[model samples]
Target: MIGRLNHVAIVVPDLEEGARVYRSTLGAKVSEAVDLPDHGVTTVFVELPNTKIELLHPHGEGSPIAKFLESNPSGGMHHVCYEVDDIIAARDKLESDGMRVLGDGEPKIGAHGKPVLFLHPKDFMGTLVELEQV
Candidate 1:
């Protein structure tokens, strides 16, 4: 089952500008950009009192974010990540409940270096859900 809200991911055309808006304009604490080649994204984390906001930009032409940006040129909320005690168990439970998991249906290392899995957007009321092991 899902735990606390981990982070909300937002796809942005430019990571720097996204960070700037959160940092300088909003007066938020933003982390340095970290390139996640495996995930095909360059990310910046905006620290918050309760949760974090992740700013994601396409790392390559083949990046999934690039594909997302094609449809949503302005970029927007990509996914909402929730923490789980056991990712594999959570995945199995969701699967048995008829929820479809994305990708190969396996956990991948996320930005926080934690195991994470993505669920189909349609399964969760049109919003993509990401489960990260806490």
Candidate 2:
């Protein structure tokens, strides 16, 4: 089952500008952009009291974010991540309930070095949901 709200991801056209808006304008603590080549994104985290805001930009021509940006040129909320104590159990339960899991339906290492799984947006009211093992 889901635990806490992990992070809300925002796909941005420019990672620098996104970080600037969160850091300089909002006076937030933002981390340096880290390239996640495997995930096809460059990300920066804006620390918050309860959760984090992840700024993501396309890392390569074939990146998924690139495809997302094609439709939403100005960028937008990409996904919401929630923590889970047992991701395998959660996945099994979700599958039994007829929810589709993205990719190979296996947990992958996420930005925080935790096991993560992405659920199909259609299964969750048009919002792509990410489950991260805590």
Candidate 3:
């Protein structure tokens, strides 16, 4: 079902500052912020040797990240994405095992433009897990 670790998403109050920290301080390669209206987030990716770190900021009032920021204020780890060879098959197996999938229980186009599904945090030791099809 789960394959490899893809990327770790971090919610940031300021996308530019976050990317700057990763770029200047950590000396990482950061991408320009991209607004994803559908996902309701403006994101910047910090490319790495193995995986990536996604810095996300709320893009709109209705964004889920907006609600997250309200409580967190400083923002924090949003979710960890893992790759799956076959997302549909993995979803079915997880569902049969009683794991709850978020967002209509269907895969959506994620930040990577790949089919992705989020599983309930409670089901995965209090961590929101994203399954992305490879």
Please report, in order, the local distance difference test score of every candidate based on alpha carbons.
Answer: 0.92, 0.93, 0.92
lDDT of 3 by residue, 72-129 (tens): 8898998999999999999999999999999798899887789999999999999999
What TM-score against the true fold does each predicted structure earn? Answer: 0.95, 0.96, 0.96
In model 3, what are the clashing residue pairs, if there are any? none
Give each prediction's root-mean-square deviation over alpha carbons: 1.0, 0.9, 0.9
Tens digit of lDDT per residue, candidate 2, span 24-55? Answer: 99999999999998888899999999999999
lDDT of 1 by residue, 27-88 (tens): 99999999988888999999999999999999965887888988888989999999999999
Q: How far is candidate 1 from the true structure (C-alpha RMSD, Å)?
A: 1.0
Deviation in Å, model 1, residue 20 alpha carbon: 1.1
| Model 2 misplaced stretches (Cα beyond 4 Å) | none
Candidate 3 local accuracy as lDDT?
A: 0.92
